[model samples]
Target: MDALLFMIFAAIAVICGINLVVQTHPISSALSLVGVMGALAALYLLLGGEFIAAAQLVVYAGAIMVLFVFVIMLLNAGTEKKLAIRPWGKYLGAPLLLLFFGMMAYVVQRILPESSPVVFGAFQGGTAAEIGRSLFTVYLLPFEVTSVLILIAILGAIVLARKEVD
Candidate 1:
């Protein structure tokens, strides 16, 4: 059951990634990225990383993607102009992608354990309570700093994007 869910989510992520790259419109690409993030969150859930999956969905898929769409809309980005495909890219692209994918599979299979530690329900520390405790105790400063940095970045984006009333 877990394996089947993993495959389904993984396939969704790959398809969304491809769609993100191939889309001409900025909004369409951003939507594809949201799909990718959702698939990744599902995969994280299947791996028993409940907190991580929630964070991925809430942080990446929700907040960050909303920010991206806002930026795209603020900039009024339009559909991308299509360029001529190069012969080499047209001819060798699929072959090269397949070769690299095969190599990655071989290396990952060799490096990883037969029974992966991150399998569903194998990890014990992925609950929200444990992560919250750790964040408050050991990682509090960095977490706070990251939050502040994000706030500043958001402010900077807003300031930069505002139109001057000339």
Candidate 2:
């Protein structure tokens, strides 16, 4: 089951990455990126990281993707031939893509250190109660600060979309 889930996530990640390169439309690329993020969240859930999964979904898929789509729509970009790449872009694109993949492989190989997973006994209740308690108690200040930052981001988005008054 874990292997199947991992395979599915790997496939989605590849598709999202290819779309990032080949999709000329900004909105489509943004949506594809969100798909990648959602796949990552699912993977986190499969690894018993429910809190991280929920955070990924809420912060990336819900809030960030909505902001991206909103900005794309606001720009009123069209899918015209003008969106096509220049002649030189075609000549340089394949090599650039190859270089990017090679660099990514090198970075992954170099930076990812091996670590054994820690096994622990199951709790009496579950993670939700523990996470909630910590969020309101030990991590209360940082959590409240994050909420404030999110609020500011929401207000900034609204102001950016509004028409300016003389």
Candidate 3:
């Protein structure tokens, strides 16, 4: 049952990701992204990451997607215009991507031959409190740096939006 559920959600995530890339309209792309996020949340649940799953659903699928849709609508984004592809991209893209994937697969297989199967309860992504503890303790510097970067970005936006006096 767990394997079946994993397969289902994994397929859903892959399909939604393809849909997201293929959709031409901004709204349609955003909806496809939401579907992808939902599938990822289900995958996290299957991996026994209840907190991460809930966070994925609430923070990504709910809040971020809502913000994306709102911005798209406010901007009245239209269907994406077809762009001309570079010559090399058109001719060599598929073969290069395939080669990269094959190389990565070979390297990973060589490095982790004894990797175990992902079974439920095999790994816990920790509870909210434990995550919070690590976020503030072990990862404090990176967290503070990210907050400062966000503050700088906000300040930059405010400065850019200010009107100049005549």
TM-score of each: 0.79, 0.65, 0.84
- In terms of lDDT, model 2 sits at 0.80
CA shift of 11, model 1, Å: 1.3
**Pairs of residues at least 3 apart in sequence or in different chains that clash in candidate 1:** none
> Candidates 2 and 3: which is better by lDDT?
3
Model 2, range 84-137, lDDT digits (tens) per residue? 768889999889989998999999878876755322222233357778898899
Q: Which pairs of residues collide in model 2?
A: none
TM-score quality measure for candidate 1: 0.79
Point to the candidate with the largest lDDT. 1
Query: What is candidate 1's local distance difference test score?
Result: 0.90
Off by over 4 Å in 2: 80-114, 117-126, 163-166
Candidates ranked, most accurate by lDDT first: 1, 3, 2
C-alpha lDDT of residue 120 in model 3: 79
By TM-score: ranked, best first = 3, 1, 2
